[model samples]
Target: MARRGKKKGRPVSGWVVLDKPVGMGSTEAVAKVKWLFNAEKAGHAGTLDPLASGMLPIALGEATKTVPYVQDGAKIYRFTVAWGEERSTDDLEGQATKNSDKRPARAEVEALLPAYTGVIMQTPPQFSAIKIAGERAYDLARGGAVVDIPAREVEIGRLEIVEHSPERTLFEIECGKGTYVRSLARDMGRDLGCFGHVADLRRMEVDPFTADDFVTIAELETARFGEAGRGKPSSDGQAPQEEIRLPDRFEDIDALLVDTVVALDCLPQVSVSDDTASRIRLGNSVVIRGRDAPVEAEEACATARGRLVAIGAIEQGMFKPKRVFGG
Candidate 1:
């Protein structure tokens, strides 16, 4: 018998800003989008918890190469913290382990915000995805083991209370990578003497992608189906309710795809010539001679004819290709 090769899907490429629905895990959502696009490859920039919903940047095919750029960008989250109850999972997903009778006043809560702002140390929730000794901390916690996750420093660019009520307080935070909103709620409750857990969470922005760029799964499905005309009529002579249509060609799904270069928008750009692009594609560094080249930057995106060629550093008037695109 001969070995068989794995089946490959279409070579669909680009980013899809999915407005993930609550209760769907990040992996599940990625799989759904991958299937909907029938893409050969797929990945996501950031992992959003099942309880939280909002902008999830999904990269298909070549766009997967730009995931790290988007992941490293700043993130904004709006969450609600319910006072008086602490859950094992740090959110509404786990059992309540503690309670409190005290609710901090609006002024009091505002006063404590400064202490958590800027750079601060935070301990991740025990029931989290953090790995411990080759095992996930959450797995150990679920098995009746006391998981002690280490505290690490995270940057909070901005933190403010969006709303405050007697039972819960809504807050919005802009933070750098690795900052956990659930942990923020947990620590705030501890600081106020009213143990708390996240009641609800929604990510509003992830770097280049904002609320405006988000596309609901329903909308994506409708667009895919509407373009593919895969909807079939039922016995009632009405078309069956279609969740999404699977496109047969990559061009058919162009409306939903975002250019790969959009992920590198934060970096400085250097315009190169066609010859320079060819050299970069061949893993060669080219001397910066164009007028559009950035004067100075730690890293930059090189484009030729308005197409992303590479992302690399410029040294001594030379553009080096750390990662080449469209190769």
Candidate 2:
């Protein structure tokens, strides 16, 4: 194979919501956006199947740092279930194993839907990205080997029957991060004493994002070209530039993006003195004057408070590191 050449791209920092197109894998979409933005550092917050489409958060530049923030967020999808067959992949296009002669009505689907709501244990489909012996489970599945995958906990916050037909069923769901709609369809079919497979799947929303938040590759290109064409300055000598831009508006931009640190807005802010800030910068955990305790700098990452409970007002005063915690 020819050696891959040096990567050439611009660097952009911040999060950009995208409207993913169907039939394209999540990685493909992310690469396309990286090229569109010419950014060297970019990552997607969540993965969507080639058969699925909708709001996918693309982290550009430092925004990628917040991937964990939204990775576990609640998600929603609009999917179509074909009520007569089951496939190896749990969706259409895969080899099907079972078929049914009976048909299910919309009322029946609605009535059975409530059983999926709330906490539920679900078995992930064999054709998925789960790991088996440190290798992708899908790889083993495609090789024709059977894998006895175990069931895992996944929550379906809501499941609604939108439409039903003799040939197909369309429904929507809000579920936990790892819930598989394909598996849900298969299980639904089993419950109905028939067979079912996902005919179509489209993610409609993710935290801080929705179908309305997504941007397609075409749209991203258009936006870039639009910026390139915007030679007219705002005359205030403060418009914006392209290809490379800093997140000076970090506050507002992060408003649309998920927060790396949980409860940032709800947490109190302690003004660190020059010396204290310097010490914290050096990775030293220090104690704040108030709050009844001292904590490592990382602990502030949680709520700006140390190991102890948050005290009263936190004025603009210098603070030391408490403890290092997750963002």
Candidate 3:
């Protein structure tokens, strides 16, 4: 297949909370949405496996600048673990390497949840995106190389059983960044002595964005090109029916894009003066002094005239722009 050239698009900045469908890679989904919106620059906050689905927050234009903050936020995922078989990839996509007839009872699973909660050590699956010597771990594993991934501490706020069957167990987990649901399932299975793998997974929320904010691709298409369908026949039953025409303009697409400030909602907001905002934009630091100014050393979102100006730190009354948002 011949490679297609990139499309020339306007500078459209904002976040799109896409209810991504399963069986699509994160990169491919980002590309599709970028093309649909004709955005000049676009990126996604986190990677959802081709088998996983749900809230994939895509950052377009200036919104991409805040992707790191969003990615660092907590995430919620509901996944299923299929017992009796452990796969090489820790998910159904890979070959089974071990099996067992043992199945942990509901009570037994409940007792084990506490051990996995809080900060626990988790070894990422060999077939993961983690880098090993500058190469993807999955790529190395697929090439039949023995990959040894060390266990790292990950914070899990919550891990509970939503449902449990003889063949599979459903769980919902609220965890911090760098946590992998597949690895959780694998470790849980090992502890229960059933040897399992992730059968299904869906991210329900990612910090600031929840399932309620997600929009399907079809909905986006309709928003871009309004309700364009053949009108029904009149009472008199005329010839056929005229098609409903709707405005298809760039501004129409903009309506669907969320404000970039939504990504920084979790942080404290500091309203700055025009002069301070301009100085920050010019890569200069300004002193923030006022009753509402953030106290102590911490990160804050600086806004001027109701628009996000910069994300920076406040230390000793000085606000240093760590990442500035540009139009």
Q: lDDT scores for all predictions?
A: 0.85, 0.67, 0.85
User: What TM-score do all the candidates reach, one by one?
Assistant: 0.90, 0.73, 0.88
lDDT of candidate 2 over 160-232, digit per residue (tens): 9888898798998999888989999999998987789998888887775656555555555445445443322
lDDT of 1 by residue, 1-327 (tens): 998988677777789999888988898888877766767889999999999998899999888989999999999999999999888888999999899999889998899999989999999888888999999988999899998889999999999999999789999999998898889888889989999999999999999887778887776656656643365233322234766343465454568787888899999888888887999989998888767666566799888887889988988788888988884
RMSD of 1: 4.3
Candidate 2 yields a Cα-based lDDT of: 0.67
Best by lDDT: 3
lDDT against true structure, model 3: 0.85
Give RMSD to native, each candidate: 4.3, 8.5, 7.0
Query: Residue 177: error of model 3 in Å?
Result: 0.7
Q: Which stretches of candidate 2 lie over 4 Å from their true place?
A: 1-11, 226-327
In model 3, how large is the Cα lDDT of residue 272?
86
Question: Residue 264 of candidate 2: its Cα lDDT?
Answer: 30
Stretches of candidate 3 off by over 4 Å are 1-7, 228-248
